[model samples]
Structures are given as structure tokens and as C-alpha cells.
Target: MNTVATPSEVTKGKHQIDLIDGSFTASEAQDLVVPMLTKKINFHQIKRMSLFEKNHKDTCAPDRDRILELEEAKATVEDIFLQAKIEGKKVKMHSTIHITLED
Candidate 1:
């Protein structure tokens, strides 16, 4: 089968969001994963740049660090996709985003 991604609607006061849970072919997995990672990386990059512009220095260390981490994750994901593509395998992926209210 192809990729099936069913995103659940967020309920009131819900802390967890089900983003994707499905099986996907290698190409489908790459299509689904790469864009998400790219978007997240772009977000952090923009945030970091904005902070730097505002402060005239590298003020968003956390965002910078997160961008690096996401880049590494993207690389690892690419490797997994490459292996799956070579092996003619499908990948089962489940992703959830959790929101927390912190003091």
C-alpha cells in the first residue's frame, strides 16, 4: 500500500497530538519525512536569524542547537530511507507531538 497519514484533530486541553501513524514505501517515507525536517530546520534557522538580527549577536543558542540536532536527525533519516529503498522495504512510522504547559 501507499503512505497513509491521518492527522487527528486537537481536542480542548489536549497535550498530545497524533501527527502521523502509518506504513509507507521508501519514496513515500522520504516524501513525508524530508519536508517535515526541512520545515523544522527552516523554522529554527529563521528564529535564530531573527534573534541575531534583533540582538546584534547570536542570542538564540537554543534554536541554533536545535537546528544542528534536526540536521543530524535528517541525515540519519536519509540513511534509513536509502537502505529501505535498496532493500525494497516499507517503513512503519508513527509520530506524535506533545505540548506542555511549563511554568
Candidate 2:
């Protein structure tokens, strides 16, 4: 039988299941310590962070370091777009401009 698991299950070595298939499960932080004591599994705190998290602590990075990350994201997007365009898929980016009136 297909079972659905919350992120906690994954970190805990429990049954495997896909959440995309329509199972609802939630994880709590309190459950983690039992596995830490008995399971001997190595787990990091990153799983606790939301998928959409953008940690801004990187401003401390040197000037060149940040630009390299920006450039890589740009290159990856450009490569995917070029392939999509060649495959006859429609790719469009919409933008809006805001105007400010003089006081």
C-alpha cells in the first residue's frame, strides 16, 4: 500500500510516500530527538526551514562571491529557455512598469 509521509518521516527512516499523490501529513520538531538518540541518523536543521526561505546572511560574502551566484542563476535560466524555445514550447515573460508622479 502506498503511504504518505511528512518530512519528519523522511528524516526518521519511516515508510516512504509521495506527498504529491494527495496525502496530508505534518511534522513537529519534538519528534526529532527520539531518532537522534536511537536511530543514529545524521540530520541537519535545514529541513525545518520553509522551502521558500531566502536567508539573507550572505551579504557578508565578498563582492565577487555574490555576483558569481547571480551569474550562475542567470546562465541556468538562459540555457533552459534556449532549449525550450528550440523545442517549440512557448515561453513568455510578462513585466509591468510603475510610474511615479512628481509631488
| Best-fitting candidate, scored by TM-score | 1
Q: List the residue pairs that clash in candidate 1.
A: none
Deviation from native of the Cα of residue 78 in model 1, angstroms: 0.6
lDDT string, candidate 2, 20-41, tens digits: 2221112211132223323221
User: What is the TM-score (0 to 1) of candidate 1?
Assistant: 0.79
Judge candidate 1 against the unseen true structure and give its global Cα lDDT, from 0 to 1.
0.87
Best by lDDT: 1
TM per candidate: 0.79, 0.29
Model 1 lDDT tens row, 1-103: 5454345433334476678899999899999999999999999999888888889856687998899999999999999999999999999999999985555
Per-residue error at 91 for model 1, in Å?
0.4
Deviation of model 1 at 33, angstroms: 0.9
